[model samples]
Target: MTTTPARRRALVVRGGWDGHKPVEATDMFVPFLEDSGFDVRIEDSNAVYADREEMDRTDLIVQCVTMSEISPEALAGLIGAVERGTGLAGWHGGIADSYRNSSDYLQLIGGQFVTHPARHPDQREGGEADNFLCYTVDVTDLGRTHEIMSGVEDFTLRTEQYWVLTDDLNDVLATTTHPVQPYHPWHRPVTTPAVWTRAWGKGRVFVATPGHSLPVLRDTSVRTIIERGMLWASRTASE
Candidate 1:
């Protein structure tokens, strides 16, 4: 007799800053996860992280919360879960800009959002659109061969180009350059990781710095990368 295979479980935790539109952003991917044969569960709070019983059963985590505070217990549970083999994947501020207070979280993800320098002089008054700029995302040599980035040519975007602080631990897949302009104080052009992955024990982590808005997320290349990333980061039930 043949036995049925168990469906993989995906936990989506989203909330925090409204500017990132966490709800709408995450909603875009739920259908994809379902189609991919995942048993998807979504929570608006990070408090779910502390539920070790659920976390232990999770195969992948898709987080979209931005600038939110996670309790110590929940944070610890999250770290423990990932270290134990639960995959983590997110984009833009949803992952990079969330939990600023936790250095441990930063260490796990291997990157953090610093700022997005405004491109237009007239629009530099702190609105979201002020930082929008036209830039190219160049794939790295390693990216040319990696499963997540292979065959994906360098692409350009007219959106927020994130200036992120990252470490050498990340396996960077693509990068975008922040050009030096007279309006910004920085003297030299800064090139930051646009997409990357990290290996945390048995779990995998995937992050892309381009999903600042729905339009950006909807970009053909961006959407493809994120979809690939979620699949790549998910843990197999047998594993």
Candidate 2:
């Protein structure tokens, strides 16, 4: 008799300003996680961390959180879970730019979204703005060989070029440069890490820069990269 494999579990927490596309983006990732054999739990409330036991058992944590202050207990729980080998993956500012007041969150997540020298990174800065700019993404040394980026193609995104400050230890997968910075208050030419990864304890991190728009996630290259990240980040659980 064949026994069914234990089902992998994932939790998604999302909420913030409407402009971050929180609801819409969270909806998009649900099907993907479900397709990947995850019993997905999409939580509109950030209080999912109230249960430390639940967080401990999760195979992956896909969060769309942005611009909020996560309590210390919640932050510690998340870090501890990942360190115990629960994969952590997300895209854009939703996960990366989340927990604004928590430097501990930023450190655990590997990087933060600082400035978008172009139009707003999500193009919702002024509202009703849809004009786009295209730029090339360069794959770096650690980028080319990582499983998360194994089959990803370096493609351009017709969206806000994110300017991020990343640590030297991060496995940077892709980068894009913005020449429009001269018009802004920031004086230097900006080069953002379009994609990157770093380990938080025993768990792996997979992050992408293309989730700024719902439609942009439709890009063949963007979807491919995100898909790979989910699986790659979840490596510990699968093993």
Candidate 3:
């Protein structure tokens, strides 16, 4: 008799401020993963894993939450699962900007989104907003050679150009830029790493700064990027 491989499961957690668009945005990933053959388990609260033991069976974790304090035990449980090789993937401030109050959290995730230099406090994509920028991103690293970006040509996307960023142990997979304050030390002419990947432990991290809205996430290029990111970071055999 032939043995069947177990189906992979994905844990999707969503919550926090509405501005993050957690509900609508994360919902976009549900069907997407299903199409990929993953048995997705969607949860709106961290309490779902409160059992403290449920993390054992989970294979991948995708956080869509903006900002929500987790119990020490709960936080540790989540991190522990990822450390054990479960995948951790998300976009925008949801994952990168998450747990701002926890230094350990920052260390585990790799980077954070401090600010957007060229972006005004209130603006829309392609509006009359000054310095609003968008450009085609070049995926030159080994990440592009992989199946996720395979056949994905250099694509164009319009996001409030991220002028505020930090450069450390980051693998810049894609980039773009907008002008910032001329007097400041970093007020030079350059585009930044708009999409990147980093490592934490035995696990992996995939983050994209372009998911400012459902429309952007829904774009053909953006969707492919995030999907590939999930598979890349997840602890699945395909990775």
Candidate 4:
């Protein structure tokens, strides 16, 4: 008798601050995942993390929660699931900036969004700003060979270039430089990772920092990179 291959499962947990357009961003990729042969489950609550059984069976988790609090039980379940081999992938503050109070979450993701410097008249010593700027994302030599960056090339984007606090463990794929501006304190260009991957136990972790809005996310190169990253993170055979 012939048998069909079981489709991989993906859980997308979205919703924190609406400013990130979690619904819109997640919506952009849901059909892609479904078309790529994944059984996709969408959730707006972090409570999904508390369901250990569900997490255990999931092949990948794409989260877009920004600056939200995750309960201890839910946090533990999320962490444990990734550590035990379920993939985790996200972009912008959704993953990097989410759960600011959870150190375990930070360590798992390998980075945290600290600030996105902007040109403002009254910018104080250490104040944050939301100004957008034009920058180029250069794919690293290592990235050139990585599956997630296969067809991606160096490209320019106008968005909030995130300045993140990162760990050495990340396998950086692409990077961008923050040029010195009058409103900024730094005198020289500061290079930051634009896309990267790291491992949490047997699971893979992928992050792309340029998805600040749907337009940015829809950029040809940006969209391609994210789609590839998602597949790579899930360890998809076709990736």
Task: Write down the lDDT of every candidate, Cα atoms only.
Answer: 0.92, 0.77, 0.73, 0.89
Clashes of each: 0, 0, 0, 0
Model 4 lDDT tens row, 126-157: 52234677789999999999989987889998
| Candidates arranged by TM-score, highest first | 1, 4, 2, 3
Candidate 4 similarity to native, TM-score: 0.93
- Model 3, which residues run further than 4 Å from truth? 1-3, 49-51, 119-132, 163-167, 180-186, 237-239
Q: Could you arrange the candidates by lDDT from highest to lowest? A: 1, 4, 2, 3
Compare the candidates by lDDT and give the number of the best one: 1
The reply for model 1, stretches above 4 Å from the true place, is: 1-3, 123-126
Itemize residue pairs with steric clashes in candidate 1.
none
Model 1 scores what on Cα lDDT? 0.92
What TM-score would every model get versus the actual structure? 0.96, 0.89, 0.83, 0.93
Query: How far off is residue 31 in model 1, in Å?
Result: 0.7
Of models 2 and 3, which has the larger lDDT? 2
Alpha-carbon error at 56 in model 1, in Å? 0.7
For 74-157, candidate 1 gives per-residue lDDT tens digits of 999899999999999999999999999999999999999999877658767767778888999999998899999868999999
lDDT score at residue 12, model 3, on the 0-100 scale: 93
Output the lDDT of residue 121, model 4: 64
The RMSD (Cα, Å) of candidate 1 is 1.3
